[model samples]
Target chain A: MLSIKNISKIYKGSNKGISNLSLELHQGDICAFIGANGAGKTTTIKSIVGIHPFDKGEVTLFGTNLQANPAHFKSMIGYSPDTPALYPNMTGKAYLELIASLYEIDEGERNKNLAYLLKELTFETAVHELISSYSHGMKQRLVLISLLMHNPKLIILDEPFVGLDPNATRFLIDEMKSRASEGVIILYSTHVLEVAEKVCNKLVIFHKGEVVVNDTMEHILQKASLDEIFRDVTSDD
Target chain B: MTKLTLLFLFRLQNQLQLANLNSSNKDVRRHAFYTISGYIVAFLMFLGYVLFISIDLNIDNNIQAFFVLISSILFWAFGIWDILSGPDDLIKSKDRDFIFSLPLKTWQAKLLPLFSKYLIHIGLTFIVLMFGYLVTIAYIDHFFLAILFVLVLSLIIPLLSTNVTFLLAWVVRHVLSIIKWRNHVTESIITLGLFVAPLIYLIRSSASVDYKEWFIQASILRYPLNEINSFSFMQHIILLIGITAVTTSLVILLLTAFHHLVSSQNAVQSKKRRTNAIWHTHIPVTALLLKEFKLYFSSLTYVSNTILTPVAMIALNICILVGVIPNLHSFSYDVAGFTITAQHLFTFIMFTCVMLTTTTSCSLSFEGRRIWIMLTAPVSLIKIAASKMAVNILLFLPGIVLTAVVYAAIFQVRMLDLITIVALLFFSLLLISIVGFFINLHFPSYTWNNDMEVVKQSKATIITAIISMITIPAIIAVVYTGNLYLLLLIMGIEIAAIIVLLQKISCNNMMLN
Candidate 1:
């Protein structure tokens, strides 16, 4: 559902950001994007979501070139950043409602999705409180809820499981698997190999700014475990 | 002493790194330039005050006292604010956790971070007040003593103010807790008391009397500068030492008490939850505008500080219109003994109204890291910019209208002139808001940890100030020429230009590094 082709974002006076990075994900695919620190995982995600303008190459969402129709492209994708980059003073429900309105999600659908998600994520009571007062896990759950509120076809979550407690983490894993089963494209970056091995059917490994591996998890883990493979792949040249 | 020295050096190294970032990064450099321009404007204002005192008023004693008193009060007010918010930086900092995990003494670990964060505030105050002192002092030459007094007073002011603030807070909290009152009630009462005291006084006394005179008289009781020249050298030394000793000891005692009080009160009063019922509105711009207002109003510090100048301007205009203070010679320029007319005074007010409505200028920066949501949302950037502009206009409209109405009634302006005045001020506000929004788009700083940095200290605000310096004069010229057709032409062209600029900024690139 999403295609990133030869995209390179070079920070001025530095050789740090992504370089000639490319990725593709289709429906019913949970692509686990694994990388070490500064491996251009976030840069690539940001570039694809149109947050950081790439210096080179094109990104297409559901056959629509992002530059040609950015509005349509953005509407079809749900991006949940690593940090809960939300208005601190806003209530969780207000933020979700805002996201719903922006994505043109109808009131009935928004309410149904919100109720289910709040209960499932165990943040039903906390939704009325200010987001500023929420714990890290609560904020992560809220961000995830906002991401799912729009029912976007493609979901891009960066380090989505960082602050989730064990219960929430299990729920998130189950939800991703369920969404993937329902033919939604899930692209998530994480350092947690065990979760990725268990939940993600496809694995894409990034070293430096370039993708080193893009194949099924079974194929990548044929000889070694996910952790050993990740260590071997990201080790020094 | 050794730990403090090492910690101070580490703090200094971080400051140097920040300075380097400001110089090396283009975006940071631009922001630094704007912030420095703000400082330059403030310094020039101080210079103007000095010139007014030296040349216009030509009164030394009262004016000197006035300057000292205003500065000290301002210092104390900030000190109190810092103390109320200080514990957050002290007890709740992630850095504190990391430092505590290291090998450090109790006081060293606790006080070093607090000092590193707050001492800059005191030091900057010292430098600015020293400049004010140098300009105001006309007595016998004691440069060394003057410097010493400024330094000593700067230290004493924060120490004394923080001590008093916490003692009062502790007392209020204890008293309220005993009486079955919530902690927020105490906070609200304290905040209300602090804000309303000056407001009530200003309303009652400022309209009828020269506000400077009131400040000059009050200075005698509040500031030590008023009494510095009266004492002999030995007496001055003794007084300084005595004040320092008392303030320092009080601070030490208060710090211990503050720690205990905080430890005892683990259950902070959480505000009642707000209802988050979704009101599905068809208009996206309205949603964005409401969001802007929500964010703006939720920050008490942002609203109070940004609104203070505009509120004071309105009050001054009222004082003038009512013939209470007779006339406004304070802001008027005496060029070749020709006192400018009230029209020029109205121009000054318009200029101030445009300048003080900073809601639009820093709104983008205020988005901080959350800007990603806007960038990735299906909503157009024009809608975002328009929402910000609308909020700015709505915020300044009531005050501008009230002030303009009073001026019109007092000046006996005809309907045509009143309409002209209102139209002109509204157009100026639109133009300034656009200019500020554009500058922010170019030099946005989203890395700020504090809202104050984005709202007040960003490069966008300074750039807006510089643009105002140009726009205000052009506006004055338009009014000074008094051609109705030309005024219409200018306003029309400005609206068109604003539309085009908004379109260009949105279409090209909305985010800056």
Candidate 2:
């Protein structure tokens, strides 16, 4: 359960980001936050995660205000950046172990998740190698593993499937569903419409930093195809 | 008179800082600024020798001046060219191949940089010399002609070197594909040029105090610039022009050769990874450091930065202290158990080790994009910071101790001073390591396009190092002025301050560092 109330970010000394946008989510909800590049999706997500400050909005995780208690909220959420910002010098296992240690996961849960993620990602062999030597796809998988290490309640992913292989992509979609079914809320964002249309339970199309649509998949689909709606929303630009 | 394609070469020199840097490392728009600032700072620091040395009709007294000035320019020129062009030269995009596939000739693209380089070179130096000659000095026999000669000399040197380096880049880029000795050879050349030059020149010049004995090989610059016949200024200008014309012609030839050797179809084939000599050191942080170490070590830029650069600087100093320090070569070894070299070396070694802790300062900031993983993880913020601190201590401790011990063995360090040096060194590292982390944490500029930008250009790191370096000496001064009990009190105050600062910084680090 994540809630954003009137969230707006104005970068200092520069006029940027959206204004007065808000959203609320619940567990098992697969919300697709759709926007083109620079449509304030990142700004909203960052505000929720306490990475950047917002000028006119409040973000709360499980009824705890992010501003009032950031560390508490942060521990309960998993955020994946659009960019794979990995420590090039760190090995896959070293990185995973670092995440595990930080989350303060006990040895058993840490081992189980590390093993499961590495196995699922087909990275068991390569996880011992330094992340710098890994290709783009491998880095993406590692970030996913780091995000999933703690199994936080709400998952916020920014363009998670950008560089993944088709098999990895399939595994990701299935994993999101399974995780959601187990009562973890998923907030997946992408520019691609088809993936969002097929997987997301609730679709929220963002245009000009305001929510243009938010409903169950069938309700959003009743108006138009996801592609048609995306065109309509972006056509105003 | 036909125009020889001169664009007031001296004017270009005035605009050198036009390529100045913007302070923000994250923004790529300011790269032109970053690069040019680096170039100008490095270039101007070198030209200090030029300003110090008088260049007159008497070239003998100015021989040291000439050597220092010309070599400074060449050193900076090579550094700048390498800094500016190396990266673009390394990467050949699919689009570049496509462009080359078109009717456009390779010389058109390659020759443009060379021509512009001549403008830049003349622009870089000639104007300053001209200002000195025209505004400041009125002793010129032929002011106009002297300016012309300076212009020619300026153009010729950079033109000659840029073309040669471009040719070398093609060769090194290609040769590296087959054989990998390019780095070794290049480094050897730089080492000889920067460090061994004075020794070589001293020996050669000292042997030939009488010019007639070495008439054909009196000086490298004299042979190159023909400043020998300075009685007639026009002849001097003509010779300078002649050299430029010849060198330009040679560059054209080299460019033609480059066009042939570098085929249009060529792409930088991914290099085969080296496997011959793997490091087998079993260490805790080994896996984490191996990738960064390999990335930094294998690449010339990083290798020079992290290890080779400092070691090379130390080696250069060793040669200077051993060969040419004013009185060290013939100095006394015992003065209450202190050698002349030993005192300076102890202070120097301690300064260097504490400074060495700075190697880890930017390591975290370098992980700009990936910092979120550390932030979101269950690992306490302190552990993450400690891992980085450990790497820095890992960077600082051994080298410091080893060098101190080596110097101790070589010199008569009284046990008291040795203890002092050891205490100072450890405290210095402790102070440096903590401040280094806090600097990066508090003002972490993680989003840097250039590795040099993170290490060298980070303001936080530089300021922190300066403050800590200053603080240690200031504390020592205050402590030494008082009794041992007072020294203990001061150390207590420092430790208390550090702990408080650490608490405050670590508390805020989740946001800042």
Candidate 3:
């Protein structure tokens, strides 16, 4: 279970990034955070990932205060940034190993998980090659493999499917489904309402740094499609 | 084939122009100007020195110097070529992907730029050399004949320099193909020396060159003033023309083979070759350390900067020893100590250089936005810092040792002094590692795209290194004599103890965010 209380992020600038907000998320839930460009989705995610600190918020992850043991909290949550930063010179395997080593994966288990993940993702011998040579889609597949199947409390990503081809996207969608079956909380941010409608169990519509609605798909949809719901909530802002 | 080389060369010129304007690697642009400007100033200085020296020869040094300066101006005219062509000619840049898949031959792409850039490089440097000759021409009685001979000499000099540079690198590249151990050994040595060229040169220039003791000198160009202009011009020209043509042919053949070599290097990166063997087990910290090391070493730019320069130091020694760079400026052989040998002096230079090059000073800057990865990864920040520190030490050790051996040989020092020097260098290295850690920690430039900025502009690194260099000799002097060794031991303990103190400070800093 994840709970956010009194999460008020007032970004006072030409374009504010976040404002007073509150929400709760739980396992076996795929929460789609939908917002337009310059909306608070990325900023909110950045704060959660500790990439950027929030102005004011007390986040509690699985009953532990996020700040009390930030590293431990982070280690239990796998994050894939909008543009995944892979060491260009590192091979797919090498990059994965670096992450795995940090997550403190055991040798035998790491090998097994890596093999299974790579196979599922259809990564070839190119896994051993330098990522400097990898295509954009290949880089995403590697990051996806890094995030999944670790029993992480939360899986957070920003536009996880931006560069992926159709086949890779389908494979990724299927992987996310299986990951969710294991009671993992998946928090992904995207601007595509259709994608959010299809993959997400819960929907959080944010505009001008405030969450207009965050509830189950049907409840938030309220006799209307996500696109209509999005238009209604975001139009005034 | 030459026609193709010319066409390919023109395209490279265009590409180079783009690189100068657009290279994300900013130093590539700056270094191009620096090399050119350094030549210009150094040339002017050289002319001034030559003019002063010529006065004793009863020659009108001013006229000679003025002519020499003009010759230098003519040389700088080639800077148009270099600035137009840029370092992008030599380096593989961001645009290679678009160019690589094109219908062009690989040799056409690679050799044209390599050949053209050097052509310009020689032009720039040779102009300076010609300025010296022009000054001498003004003093000579046969001014017309001197001018005529000098023109021929000037053209041949750049041609000769370009041909020699191409041939030397070609030979080294080929020899590397055949001699595996030698290539690695040589590369390591050059990488080590890159850390200390100025220091090595300062030490060497300060020391007296011993002509009778052949092994006693690291510079082959000893007494450059004695023979800078004395070589038979016509005879050398005839000889040089022959050498240039022959070398040009060999280089063309080498260019033909370069395609295969680059493809092989690419295959290793692109085809997913097997990694070097890894141990079956590793602690988390060790694993992270290995990853950081791998990241640095595998990078094309970093590897070139780190390993290639030190390994190439052998050639530098040869150049110095052979008097390749004409002594236009007054120089000395005074290094750390007058008693220091060429080999030991070489070591000290590499030691300082490697310390300079290892670049723990900017590891934080290198992190960029990805610093959160370190913060989030659950690894101890100190371990990350330690691994960075360890990588630098391990990488520099081989090159430093090579320089020390060479220095020991040149100085004819006993084993004891060598041992003492090693101990002193070792402590100095330790002190630098600790201080470098704090320098980086105190003021990390997270936005730097260039290692040069990180290495050069990091105020802490510059200030600390300057301070260290001044204090090192004095510390060694004291440490060698009395209870200073105990003091050093005490100092090491204190530094180790300070890690705790620093951790508290860092924790507070981390809290501020």
lDDT of 2 by residue, B329-373 (tens): 354445476443434544554455455546556666766666665
- iRMS of every model, one decimal? 2.2, 7.3, 5.3
Q: State, as a TM-score between 0 and 1, how close model 1 is to the true structure.
A: 0.82
What interface-residue Cα RMSD does candidate 1 give after superposition?
2.2
Supply the TM-score for candidate 3.
0.68
**Superior candidate under TM-score, 1 versus 2:** 1
Considering every candidate listed, which one attains the maximal lDDT?
1
- What is candidate 1's CAPRI-style docking category based on DockQ? medium
TM-score of 2: 0.70
Best by TM-score: 1
Chain A structural similarity (TM-score) per candidate? 0.97, 0.96, 0.93
TM per candidate comes to 0.82, 0.70, 0.68
Q: Which stretches of candidate 3 lie over 4 Å from their true place?
A: A3-23, A38-40, A53-59, A63-68, A205-216, A229-237, B1-91, B98-264, B268-272, B275-281, B300-304, B307-357, B364-375, B396-424, B441-513
Flag the better candidate by lDDT, 1 or 3: 1
lDDT of 3 by residue, B35-114 (tens): 34544565677668655544533442234333333333333333222221222224354345655666677766656545
Clashing pairs in 1: none
TM-score of chain B of each: 0.72, 0.63, 0.56
DockQ of each: 0.56, 0.27, 0.42
Name the better of 1 and 3 by TM-score: 1
